[model samples]
Target chain A: MTDPPDRRPGGRTARVRAQVLDAVRAELAEGGHEGLTVEGVATRAGVHRTTVYRRWRDVGGLLADLISAAGEIDWQPPDTGSLRGDLTALNEEILESLTVRPSFAVALMAASFHSEQAARAQTRLWEDRYAQCEVVVARAAGRGELPPGDTDARGLLIAATAPLYHASVLMRADPDPRLPARAAAAAVLAAAAGAFSAGGGTA
Target chain B: MTDPPDRRPGGRTARVRAQVLDAVRAELAEGGHEGLTVEGVATRAGVHRTTVYRRWRDVGGLLADLISAAGEIDWQPPDTGSLRGDLTALNEEILESLTVRPSFAVALMAASFHSEQAARAQTRLWEDRYAQCEVVVARAAGRGELPPGDTDARGLLIAATAPLYHASVLMRADPDPRLPARAAAAAVLAAAAGAFSAGGGTA
Candidate 1:
């Protein structure tokens, strides 16, 4: 079967998709979710409005595609020698993404709250990222850094990283230089104590 | 001096404000941020559009006032005998708020991302809640549950509660019933190890 014109990679379809998604990010960063509109994005992308309407449908579709595009980036979890180091490196990367000016990450997050399509796409991206990071726990266990038995990598990772989001996104607090390491250290201590051991009721 | 009519408690101004803010929450819960509009809120509140316009000016203004009203609520941190218990209680409350159907808390949080005024109001509310929760850490220190030093109550609290928000909000994961106590236990263990001590760089 022949591939559709829009489905061909490195073709005009791919170019339009890239242009539209870039415009979506630009609009979100500059004006936030409130100002993002199909017409505005189409104008910014130098694409026809009817083309955007037909392909993307609305702002929700644009947001969903933007999040899906993020998933396509070649990203990997930090692989420092120790779990503590790895988690800290991971956190630093997160901090950088969240704190960058006109942060595309933050804009995407805000967009997710406003769009069901975006929210579902974000959830898939998060699940994929967490699955990828499980190797960090596996490596730590192999090195005997964690207690014997299965550790809840999901729980551990959440504990290690949630503070950054809480402080920056929810509380809107000024970024503290030491927080990434401190939070990672705390999670490490807790994990070593088996707080995140699977099926364990509590520490 | 006599209070201005609008400034008097229990007067028409206060009633209108209450009605309008309640309407805002209802609209946000039902329609998310996209469905929120000054006209919708005013109509839902049974107030004249001019009255809402004169007072709230826009959807952002309505959202800000709604968040400010949340701060007016008389609330206290749980005083369970142990720090772990107290934190668990706090986490449970947080979980309930986040997981409730048509959750006003979640809606308000989503609204904050779209409006600068609402964001500032949410930041203030978070600061106040954190300040109130400091007593939990203080009580723990008094009982020798925490290390002998200035504990970073804010940091500890963030760690304990962040997992719930991360799982439920960001990941869109199903609520884990044991998470509140499990997370509290992890934070307690970390705190006892001096991970949260203000001057301690890392555990």
Candidate 2:
């Protein structure tokens, strides 16, 4: 530990970890990326710098934990047996991820610029998210909810949410429930079906 | 304005301006929005501080000029008989914008954080681009390329390009011509048609 091991017999380790994360988030909010430092985090958390370093190999690791802990929506697309229902549920989940923790959101995005670890973490987060969509998509395809030969459906599904969520996160825009996702969903399915019918099923 | 206010000055003025813009873009490429500043840009351009400030009132103005001047797409959507041709044209333009001027791309995105001026500028740019699509849309509508009451077709046309464009810019990803635009165009139109035709052109 930089100061000394904060083996405070009065408190549990989990609580201390939470405190450290809270400090990191607060620092990020106050100073953008420039504010966060291991020593500063230690001082705020009342933990040793060595303790923080020990727990996380570096700054990125510590930030990664914070982001991972921030809150991810469970992969649960509604099975209303329609494409509309599936898309609505998916969009709601994306909105939740974007809205739940604003500071963590900004920090992760900014950190993604400077840290390979953050970029990888961000990429994995997206992969996990897109995988969730694929389940509902496959089900929709089987049920004929999606048009045949509409293999491009999933890409549109994500294109729907990515921009709206990105606008909220990066631009700090007032969340518009209907812009990117709803529009993409409405349009994507339309074009896919038209193209599919035009091509004939076998084509 | 930097070297001199000589509007009819020799090619030297043009070269100096190019050098400065190159420096700004380089800075943005290396470090995102946070690295852009008069001091940093001046250092990179090998120009005096007064020059940058004199030509452009602030970073926002300089950034705006860069966006309007260099980022202008070569062509807008033309009066094509099919919606597909117009949308393809528009999306291709967006992809071209993203690939070439990545620095200004990030700047356009980051500027949204600082002021409504940026938002207005961004919105105007989108609207201007959308106007280009509007012509093809109106032609298509008159020709029965779409149903009678297609409310979100404009939104759909944009969905093919905007979200994907926003993502590639923010995530620093290579712009893929085929998947994001072509797939999205196909899918979005399908979804839009489904939503509308199922509703008897009410959607």
Best by lDDT: 1
Worst 10 residues of 2 chain B by lDDT: B194-203
Q: DockQ, per-model, please?
A: 0.71, 0.36
Per-model TM-score, in order, reads 0.92, 0.74
Error of 2 at A141 (Å): 3.3
DockQ result, candidate 1: 0.71
Q: What lDDT tens digits, residue by residue, belong to model 1 across residues B1-203? A: 34446656779778888888888878877887678888898899998899899988888888888888888899999998999999999999999999999877788788788788989998999888989999999999999998887999888989889988888877878989899999999998888777898776374
DockQ, structure candidate 2: 0.36
Candidate 1, residue B30: Cα displacement in angstroms equals 3.1
Q: What is the lDDT of residue B5 in candidate 1?
A: 63
- Please estimate how well model 1 matches the true structure, expressed as its whole-model Cα lDDT: 0.87
lDDT of 2 at B124: 58
